[model samples]
Target: MQNSLQGIELFKASVSISHQENCASGTCIDKNLLENYPPELIVGFQLLESVERSGTRRFAIHCGSADNQQHNGLLAWVFNTDLRYSFKDTSSASRSISAKCAMKVFYKHVANVQPLVNPDLGMPSVTSLEELRLPLHIYHCIKTVLEKSTSLLPPSGRKFGEWEIGLLDLESA
Candidate 1:
């Protein structure tokens, strides 16, 4: 799932960060975020991550004042399809945010995973979690084994037969 988005580039787009009616009762956490705030004609914002709940996808956006100026690293979430991939308008007017602001996009921090001692090898070998590939078939196989292993109440404390492990050769795929 994570691999599909590798090397993707950020594109500029617009979205309505509006106040839902329920947000007006002050019962909302972000109800006050846009209050008394003048809308800018253009604002720099970055689409960060997307989290799905039930069946709907809610996307996270990273927002802050332009880098040349002072701005708070504030975050906002939009629930719908991606704003970057589609264009829509008129129903909800998109507000440009900032006071004497320049639009700037901020990206989430990313770093390489560090190598660690492999538990199976005890003190002898080192391994990287990134090197291990959990393909769908293998994942389901392991999940089935685990489900069977823990199916009984109190777990039964039983040991299973020797496992057949296989590697997915990316070159073949």
Candidate 2:
């Protein structure tokens, strides 16, 4: 979707601007400063698991601050392929839930809903979901996951479900 793609670009731009600001200070960047950049400016998403039943493909996404070094948590976004809808769940839970459970719940909630155009999509367009690849932090987290799987998961006590709805919340700004 155009909105989601625009949001991904906005996030990248915001981080670039922040990095430039840090460089302009004429001092070595502090790890804490880099780690503590506003979480809202560091959005990222990963396709955790997907399922296809009938002719539809439903997927679960974990999206949140891309700064894995920080204690921030992730929000869950579900693509209800059967219903042709995307729904976000902002419920607070343990910092990390089993991917199996996440997939189960996501599908369960969306399975019974009637197929309808996503309200978030606004007016119809020529865009196809197959052509839209959501951004994910491969170099950052995947590197850590390969080296030490635990290193990439959120800290135990961090609050989940706190991410702002990307870009949509900024429309009025």
Candidate 3:
């Protein structure tokens, strides 16, 4: 099947140890304290950069979790893109289309990483070094958005809103 969303071209990705102070003198003296500590998260995207009409579609993700667990959620935004016009003209049809497209990509990113966030065994309260560390801010943002979206629905519709939003499947870490 053909994909409707434009493919993301990853330009860069990196992971760094968090709590540098804990790694004093290059030694993790407190091994238990280091366990599940959040790591620096970085991801860069250059979308459709080769296409003439694509505009400058670029965004970067930089965050670390204070809780030191798996990255439970993602925070994404279109830094620059052909959708610039939509932000300038919110009433235009392009605005809705752009928003939809942007959200699709954001969700796609989350879906791709969901397994890493929540392992197959079961949801864990803390994440390992191998797992992505989701900051509390990002988690709260996603939860708020889901709640607000459900609130906008009719009373009967609200029951299924969280399922449609896929939050139930996320399994908080």
**Tens digits of per-residue lDDT for model 2 on 50-86?**
2232222322222223322222212223332122113
Error of 2 at 153 (Å): 16
Across 17-38, the per-residue lDDT of candidate 3 in tens digits comes to 3465645586655554433411
User: Which portions of model 1 miss their true places by more than 4 Å?
Assistant: 1-132, 153-173
Prediction-by-prediction clash tally: 2, 0, 2
Question: On TM-score, who's better, 1 or 3?
Answer: 3
Compare the candidates by TM-score and give the number of the best one: 3
lDDT of 1 by residue, 20-116 (tens): 5666655564634543311111111221121222231221222321122222221111222222211233345674332221212211211211112
Query: How displaced is residue 127 in candidate 1, in Å?
Result: 6.6
**Deviation in angstroms for 97 in model 2?**
12
Best first by TM-score, ranked: 3, 2, 1
Ranking by lDDT: 3, 2, 1
Every model's TM-score = 0.16, 0.21, 0.25
Off by over 4 Å in 3: 1-133, 161-173
